[model samples]
Target: MSVIEEERVRGGVFKDINPEDEDQQPTVIESLCMNCYENGSTRLLFTKIPFFKEIIISSFTCPHCNWTNTEIQSAGRIQEQGVLYTLQVKTKEDMNREVVKSDSASTRIPQLDFEIPAFTQKGSLSTIEGLLDRAVAGLEQDQPIRKATDPAVAEKIEEFIERLKKLKKVEEEFTLIIDDPSGNSFIENPSAPQKDTALTVTHYKRTPEHNAVLGIETEEEEDDRKPVNDLDTMRNEVLVFNTNCPECNAPANTNMKLVQIPHFKEVIIMATNCDSCRHRTNEVKSGGATEELGTRITLHLTDPSDMSRDLLKSETCSVLIPELEFELGMAALGGKFTTLEGLLKDIKDLIVSKNPFMCGDSSTADRAGKLELFGQKIDKIIAGEMDVHVILDDPAGNSYLQNVYAPDPDPEMKIEKYTRTFEQNEDLGLNDMKTEGYAEK
Candidate 1:
């Protein structure tokens, strides 16, 4: 497209940008209808959005087959990282703030435990309230929530949506968080806080798995992709066969894939879903070496920057925060790749989410108090108010904890790696079997 033509497309969205281009027509591309085999039945209308740089809105429709679709595509280079926008909706005024949600953005209301995953809707320019309204509409048409077999579950979903509607009217207060791995989402900022609540935006690196789902591949990402011929890769990359669902004995398919972590190694993340019973299982396995002894690494976390250190905890890794007397094994935290702060937060959230008292049992007062105290310590550690030792022990030799200020070593940081005990090896199931399938001794 020519510069003037680009201006014409953008002018349609931003009137002030090109007032003299009133005679311009939308560019159309003719193609075969996707739904039907008919020729020259599909029409695509392209327009440029001014808010997002070089982003074009493509609307497609086929009159013959009545198939319609709308998507947002980027005409510019790929963004190096994802974007996250967070707004605290405390007043009706805040609800009026404009929002530009890309198709790849996911919405989350942590208070409600509700999430609208990416690819659920097309890109839109709307107010905060409008976004919530769309979310309510989506829930109404959601097959799983609307047609839930359990009456209580369906009713709960309905009630939660009603609360979301209240948010639009400023009758309720909740935090709205949007995560766009594609980095195409946006939220308006008025230079200062509208009321007592301020908007917070964060940009973070997206995992390779997310990039794969978004169809984004760069040279670095391509280099991290697993080769098809590797046996370990095939275990997670190939669909072995279809089998009956273990839950309902209905036919089901199991899908798995090898997701490589940038600046790190690959991992096999397997997932299985049963359509009949809706049974699902997801597991992450490391594609690293297996050694005779376990590995242990420790770091004294004191600065705020320390929280941003990269962490790769294999499924067999155990974590410890010495100051808080907190220790979680592989069974507790499982395999995860996150920042130090994120890992600490996850520990706190897990405690609260699983605590009987917090969940409404209310009988374990003593335990609840202890949990609250521990959680406070975690918060302090993350805020850099408290110094603590962070440790990772992995028997599988597949885990990693980057040296403080890694790729640049920090002199003040302490990181120690050591071997594991025979007892620890036994716990990792590394005992019993020999190379010849018999006792070595």
Candidate 2:
């Protein structure tokens, strides 16, 4: 058997059998070096994420032999050492009495390098087309849910459903954890190094076949979660963006996959997040145009196909928020999005407001009453002028993008447009232009 398989047999977390009882938690896996502390009982260790996800591996081994037996039981609580996580929030009404609280479990299921296939269940996500179909069907079918007319009645219904779902999900999650530490490689701190090199570094590699399978996944069907940063505040919202991992000074790339962001004045950008290292890398397009009209706002985004695919999905691409305009043939020249077909279709459904459209117009919610009426108008067009940005550079959405004529695709990008900013304080700035409005051709 291979070394990996051998370690799997001996020290693997997968082999851990949970004790049968209400009071017991899952066992922490460990292995002792025969040359070290082979005579002692293994101890149970627990970990928590704090102070930038540093690991504290502690165990009682024969100091002379340097052998470890007990599960490394260093009582690690993501150290609050120098962290000022808001002792309390001040309020007009003695708000200092109120404080925001966050609860993290000792077991957030350490990140693991599970094969992509592990998440490909009978449901969840399968193919790009299939997932989209499922989402569309989910929208079409009312999800077999019912509403209660009153608050009290609704509370009872929600409580019962929540209980059932919670129990079911927990049972499933327990069985799915093959290794206690899935992507957990080394505990961050300066723990004494092991005498033997048995403790392995686990990594996951996608086979050519798997890459092809993912390549076939509809790019639009991606649903990644993202955290918001409130630069205005200094609480837990102080998560670093485009920042490197505190442990290894290696570059940590981040991306945002927006879904259903209400408004740009103050908006929400949903995105897929990284499990290991808590990375936020995803695909992105860094350009667009901005046309401001008094109280009204306009946003245009360039297609992703015209940019480097590596930069688009890379964890390291810088964000450029004003290249809002797009011309055809950009993707053919290596742009942000892959192709026009899938990109446009996805954006259409989003701005059109159906089929799990993740990203939408920045001003979509500005004139709720007015835009509501205009949205009905876009539904009627098979190929009509869009009030929002619909950019792409690839032919993946559907091959039709292969023939669409997108001019100013790149060669025409004005250097001034690239540098223009409305205000230093603004989240983004673009060329201020004016369009009559969203009227058909």
Candidate 3:
């Protein structure tokens, strides 16, 4: 670790302190859909705590589409009580770090949305709006603002975009502002690039609790966790149970409809059902992982040539990516030939390779031109639940669901059976024995 990192490892200003003395974290501006702009704020729970350098950033929700792209646009001085520090994060590779200042450096500060960082909460203040506005305005303008971009107006857009990417990454930095009985100031630009170095160290702070420290893993341990095929049998077997209808509580069944689906890799399951009351919601889940389908519709690539498939599998790394099986009927799968173009070249190649008639330039290119038709097919499958035409071998026809419906795995579960009984229950009759025949006599 570098000298500054060593200081941080020891704990800045917060050393020899109680866990209760944590400084208020900075806020991040989040949203629902990445593409949509917000007209008003929507209350939301933070999915996880965010950190900038060593400083932790707060979270907020957008009233719009619910995209969670939040960021720390300013140093935590307002929240830290008027003291500011320049805290440098690190290079993209996380090789070097520097703490240029610590609540004792600069006088000029970029304005922030929240006055008190501690009071930072939902509906209160936006942490990044002002800065975001400035950055976005600079982005919207055709001119460049800094020498970073020539001609000055459109120049900062790249920087803003880079910040968005960094926010997406776990690595972030906080500008620290602190306070003492006597008023003071400090500041530095941690965003500036760090010096190049060959030797590097990963940091792990020692906590009072013995469990805080993590040991370097042995090769054997790593080999055990190495990515392998995981099959969750319960994924498709569990009934699409719905408890939302006010009346009927039967299992809400979902038929796997494959409308012209050509590239089938991850089985896309859109979970839409209720088992208690009359409410239905849908979320996408892959066949390999747990069945907690999230709210994003996914497009899976079936190409064997690209590593993108594996990259997508380990969500630990981001490459964005979906599936379903049919038991009762033949499946037809396809999509607008055009959407395939945006996918990796391998997937596009798979499409053309399978449909030989679509081979070569203009002839195949003509096929690629029909995005509207492909979209309709996908809509029919996803929206209309239309089954796709697929080849299958079912001699016994056991999958026809006629032989065995499997009867909703453990259908008759009493929710309260596993819970602990209240102490009042056992003593109820004895203590209230004055009840039955004698009122208050």
The candidate maximizing lDDT is 1
Q: Residue-wise lDDT of candidate 1 within 1-441, one digit each (tens)?
A: 666444443343322122256643446777776678664433333333333544555667777777876665544334556777788888787887767787788999888888988888887767788888888877777647456567777787788888887778877688899998877777765321111136665555688888888887644534575546767556455555576453333466776676776655777666678865477755567876576556777787668988898778777787877666566746545577678898888888766543323423232565566667778888899999997888887877777766644467666555444577787666555575465756677
CA lDDT for candidate 3: 0.28
TM-score of 3: 0.18
Q: Say which prediction, candidate 1 or candidate 2, comes out ahead on TM-score.
A: 1
- The alpha-carbon deviation from the true structure for residue 75 of candidate 2, after best TM-score superposition, in angstroms, is 25
lDDT of 2 by residue, 1-441 (tens): 654334322333222122343333443445454675455434442223222132223344544566553222212222211111111111121111111111220111122221222232221112222322332443334323434235665555455444334433332221111111122212111111111121121223333443343333323655476643643452223233553333222345444433221112221222334433353422333222222221111214244332221112111111121222222222111123333333333333333343111122212243343434434433322133333433222211111112113332333232121232354113221223334686887
- Model 2 has an lDDT value of 0.28
Model 2, position 439, has a per-residue lDDT of 86
Residue lDDT tens for model 3, 1-441 = 554333333334112212354452232343344457654333322211111112222344556666554332222212111222322223333212211222221212132221222212111112222323333444455544444456444444465555644432425542323221111121211121121132111112222331111122223433454452434543334444323221122235442321122232343434445443344533322333322112122222223221221211111111111122211111112111112222223232323333222323213343444422444443444332443421222111111111011333312111111221242222112233343665667
Q: Number of clashes in model 1?
A: 0
Candidate 1, 301: how far from true, in Å?
A: 40
Top TM-score: which candidate number? Answer: 1
TM-score of each: 0.41, 0.18, 0.18
